[model samples]
Target: MEFGVFATMAEALDAANKAQKDLVNNYSLEQRDQMISNVRKEFEKINDELSNFEFEETKFGRVEDKIDKNLGGILNTPGTEVIKTRAFATDKGLTIEYSAPYGVVGAVTPSTNPSLTVIGNGISNLAAGNSVVFNAHPFAEKSSSIAVKTFNKAVVDAGGPNNLVTMSANPSLATLQEILESPYVKLLVGTGGPAMVKTLMASGKKVIAAGAGNPPTIVDETADVERAANELYLSTGYDNTLMCTTEKEIFVSNQVLDRFTNAFVESGARLLSEEEANKVRDLIFVELESGEKVVNKDYIGRDASKILSDAGVDVEGDPRVAIFITDKDDLFVQKEQLLPIIPIVPTPNFESAMEWAIEAENNNNHSASIWSKDVYRVTEFGRRINTSIYVQNGGTSAAFGVDGTGKDSPTIATPTGEGITDASTFTRRRLFAMANGGNYIL
Candidate 1:
């Protein structure tokens, strides 16, 4: 159980290689489906255990939402979907084309989605006929370990290789490096910060690096202010906005600013008092190494009441949400503050709002949202910012399937590059060609 001491990268690779060979050697398509089904059942059994671990360890989102993500991973993270294959008889003989697994996969899980990421990536890699060696986030070690155990049990029960999915019992910087440098690791799939993604990309290996994001949600004059406020509230509060697909900033047209703010306040969000706002501005903002003030990490994902209390302000009511009304110039509006706090910036018009929104979004280049009744306005805004996901008439969480959004799994912070970490997100494709009747050459 103590993966830190016993589970070296070499051991992980050897186990994974054996699993891959077993998959190619023993299991046919029928066996693969049976294994997939067994894994899905095991996921259901461990759902509550993983959900509890995630809530206790990360404290990032709701327990219910985490459970939903676990189930979604089991149900919809993609399976073996084969494209067209061909066989032909040539003058020389017969030729056939087929797809095969890429051998051992090196996957790194993120803390924000500990259980869901493990299950999703595990299922995807299995479907691709590859074995996996996961480097889970240190913060969610218990959850990650349980996930690995559950997967391994499922595989073994289904007549597949044991340890087909392996992970370090205790993930650390040293363990991560060993996994990256291992020769048996054929490909890398990462979901973490920019530093980690950059490290994986530089390892001289094939990597599917999922990076970071600063998503923005836009509300224009033509928007349904009430619906937009409701959707935004749901998105920003879903699992405390842990998802990279969640809206990090809101850009509202001056025409609808007051209406949207009022609606937001009516929906259990509290506007910080002037004195309290000043305290938050001091406590939440800090100077970076470049001497530029930025939102402090201490407040990120902390409850609004706790943030205010730490800033020496006390509130009588139960207020979980923080509303900051500031100009676009404020550091609060211009950055990806990953807390329950929302900054509402007003622009003169829709055009100006879109421009300001894009600027506020900055380099994160992830996802954005819009709440508009006008189809043209939605289309225009989608065209303008050009984020990975441009949600209309809904919160940013809609991109990830929470609160009646489209049916999708939880997304990783690496939105700009890989978007979401789904089944295909963890795979690579190769083309196979066969000559029919003639020996042809270029």
Candidate 2:
């Protein structure tokens, strides 16, 4: 079974399936660990090149930020350690359950985090003893193909099976369709918008989908105003705010709103006046034929200075974040803007702030955060948001393990309810029972 990019999806699927079988039957857990280690080291060695290519090809995020993103994915994505064996003992017999592979997985990578997604998913899927046939986003074909090829080389060099990772040289909708229809692909993992989630769900296979999010942040009077302001500035400015987890809209308690805004300005964020904000809204959004107003694709992931400049608003210094006050029903609060622009909605009290936070999240249940010192407020906000990634007094990147504890993965399966996925999320449970003394230890 040969790995790397294949001419056809059929060839990739066949080779991937064979490679997954080899990993399961011929390779031991120790061998898998070695392979994963090689993959991580190789990722580090080529991190610069991969990040440069992805940034240049996709033009979605900053190169420096993409570099950090790749490093986070490589170093923090958990391996076989997450998989565990469970056993139960009964009066008559014993039963043990093992984590088993789902064979070959059909993964659809997104353009937003092309190489990061591939490498992270590859590490996770391979760690679970499964091979992957990636349907790379057409816009990021070259970068994604390079990632797949590099991953496969690492596995082979570590004395593991070849074709552990595979993708199409010509990634397109046709190839994605082929993967969906193929019987050999046992599971589906996708990270993209509503359309991608819908497509994967309709495939009728077990799907781990990472969909869109309008993450809302809350800042109450009890919060450390300076700390909250600084963290918000960094979170909304990181990677030009391309991540779905970035705070889109925020509800602030009126008591602390002015102080927070002042501290935010001190942190290099420019507060746009209402008139300037309206101009920005006009510049960043466009109305569709169907009367739907959405963020202009041109401004997505662009720098704050550029976004503000084009809106005819000039600033004296470099500003990484552009924030403005708006009502809860404003389009900026309702829509998930991928740019560094943020909407600040002021509430008279904490209770109203919480209510607005839930409403602004749009029920995506993807990611939300709160800046507060009150433990009761934190607990209540966490429960009310009901999001997969909830941050307490930290930036959104903390949830992804960049500046926080634990592992990181680009594919946050919010829709599929896996939260932050790792190797165990890719596997199934296989139970073994024996009539008497079934469990080996028992």
Best by lDDT: 2
lDDT of 1: 0.73
Clashing pairs in 2: none
- For model 2, where is the 10-residue window of minimal lDDT? 433-442
Tell me the spans in candidate 1 whose CA falls farther than 4 Å from its real position. Answer: 1-6, 82-99, 288-295, 316-320, 402-407, 410-416, 436-442
Model 1: lowest-lDDT 10 consecutive positions: 1-10
Residues 1-442, candidate 2: write the lDDT tens digits.
3457999888898899888988999989889999999999999999999999998998887888889888989898999999999977886678889999999999998888989988899999888999999999888999998898889889999998888889988888899999999999899999988988999988899999998999998999888889989989988988899999999888999999899999998999999999999999999999999999989999898888888989999876668789998899999998888999899999998889888889988889999999889999999989988999999888877877756865789888999899989999999999988766554463
Q: Residue 161 in candidate 1 has what lDDT? A: 74
Model 2 / residue 398 / CA error / Å: 2.1
